[model samples]
Target: MLDKQVCRNIKMVLLDVDGVMTDGSIFINKDGEFCKSFNVKDGLAIELLRSHNILVGVISGKASAALDTRCKHLGFDEIITGCKNKLPALVDICSKYNISPSQIAFLGDDVLDIPIFEKVGLGIAPVDAHCLAIANSDWVSTLKGGEGMVREFVDLLLINKLDLPLKDIYKPLLDKIRYDDVAIMEQ
Candidate 1:
């Protein structure tokens, strides 16, 4: 269960990359390039959050081109990588956004994320997250990372915090398609 007050206070969402977004898997090709998989549903969820005026950002200890491409595609408000210590990154995000710590919700999945859990208004962990991370989190998702967990969390925020109905959450997106003459299928 999520604390409605805490959820309502969230103005920004921060995410960890490896575990929270990519199932904690890192694929290195022969050329020393890294590859990662992201859930399309999570992407849609992020788009919805952004549409509703909630800022989103990413923080990771590792840096890779794949991560950069994904963040760019999502149009994240902040992207901080190669950060071994995420506390400073949090501070930077707060300062940059001019949002208080109590207005931030972070979803992370490792021991490294515990310190952040303590500071943020809402700390969320995926079902497969580290035990300590789960213990510290304000809420735990039913799904694992890279498996629509982000979508699940977003739905909760939309419905419980923002008072948007689940079915109506797609109105903004659907309206665009309906009004823009975008073809969904070719005859």
Candidate 2:
């Protein structure tokens, strides 16, 4: 967990889609189309972050319809895709927001994302991420990517940053999970 002062300094959270958002897998269907699955837990976490008025954005090195669809559905504040050089995009975002890199937090899970760690205030990686990513991250998530990783991360942020009660912040996410599980069981 980040210290209270450091967490309070964060204003935005940027995510890399392939590994940070998903399991770093891109499946091509028989029709030669790509597809990806997202965890509801991650989605809810993003929603919670948004509800707090914290900006949420996705920056992907590759462009995909799936990425566009997911970002649109999730109402991301910013979406940058098809940019291999992430530093420029990060700079652009900082320029647009009139904020310094130190005000941003980046979640990434690959070697390419290493540069961001050096730039952002807080750099985080999913548990099952690349070794380099883990090595470079300021914090490594206990949960695997696409397996409620964002949820846990957000919970930490809510608790540490705004001083929100963890029990209160966690209730909404946990309740949704329970409801979804029941729906699955009823199926």
Candidate 3:
């Protein structure tokens, strides 16, 4: 269980892109075009979270121009690409933002992200994350990657801190993203 004060202190949510944001798959075309599928509901959740003043960012190991385009469209606080040593980059972000690890939440899905999870105050892992990753996480998401996992985490965080009912606060955004076809589970 997350402490109320800890959750309240979280001002930023940093996510790993390849496995945590997408399904850990990349499709490159003959012309070197990169392709990825982002969950619309997750995008809406991010918009809502940012509206409440919680910053969101992506730190990706492999560089992709597609991710840069997506980050620009979503208005992410920061997007760090080609970061093989993610922890050092994370340190830079924390320092630049003037926020401590206790004020940040990190969501990751693989072994490389373990060091990050260990350092951040709140470590979240999706259902599809590796077993070792899950073992290190403080909270394990019920949803799979590229399937509204981020949205689910956002909803939980907001509902705990905000007074609004979950559906009332989030349904409109969910509807806009066609979440009816998506299956959200609690694990």
Candidate 4:
């Protein structure tokens, strides 16, 4: 069973970009343009959750045009970057969304994210997250960042919040293949 408190209180999901979204890799070109790799599964999960009326946002300490472009493409409800003090940003997000601190869920993987984590209802940390962050989280994913960690969190939320049938969501994709096809695909 999911936490009843979490299911009841969560109204918004906020994320930190570097560690939470991209495994904390800052790929800088010689020209100083930075890029990051995001997991496709995580992106799809966000789309599905947003479609179900849950608002999502990102609050990152570092600003990047790549992040802006990605968030725009993904249709994130809000994106507040270059946030040195995350608590104020959280406060602003809560005020703008007409939500309370208890109605927010935040995902983070570093020390800088702890303030926001402490203020939100559902604080999430990835498997390989900083030790302090993991200790602070209400929940921790089994997967690491830039893997399927976010998707795992999304699955839990879907199961509890929407009571969505897990089988119904993925059965078609699974049923399309034979056992031999699965073996072949694994190869």
Per-residue error for 27 in candidate 1, Å, reads 0.8
lDDT by residue for model 3 over 1-187, one digit each (tens)? 5566667888899988877778878998999899988888888877887867889998888788888888889999989988878988889999999999878888899889899988887898999999999999989989898888888888887776665788776656556556545545321
Give the best candidate by lDDT.
1
Residue 105 Cα positional deviation in candidate 1, in Å, after optimal superposition: 0.7
Query: Against the hidden reference, what TM-scores do the models get?
Result: 0.94, 0.88, 0.86, 0.86
Pairs in steric clash, model 1: none
Judged by whole-model lDDT over C-alpha atoms, candidate 2 comes out at: 0.87
Question: How many residue pairs clash in model 4?
Answer: 0
Candidate 4 least-lDDT 10 residues: 168-177
Those runs of model 4 whose alpha carbons end farther than 4 Å from true positions after fitting are 167-187
Q: Model 4 over residues 14-58: C-alpha lDDT tens digits?
A: 888888888888888999999889999889777766756789999
Rank all candidate structures by their lDDT, best first, as comma-separated numbers.
1, 2, 3, 4
Candidate 1 wrongly placed segments (more than 4 Å): 182-187
Q: RMSD for all candidates, in order, please.
A: 2.2, 4.9, 7.2, 6.3
lDDT of 1 by residue, 1-187 (tens): 8888888889998999888887988999999999999989999888888878999999888899999999999999999999989999999889988999899999999999999999999999999999999999999999999999999999998787867788797788777667666565542
Report the poorest 10 consecutive residues by lDDT, candidate 1. 178-187
Q: What is the lDDT of residue 56 in candidate 1?
A: 96
TM-score of 4: 0.86
Worst 10 residues of 2 by lDDT: 168-177
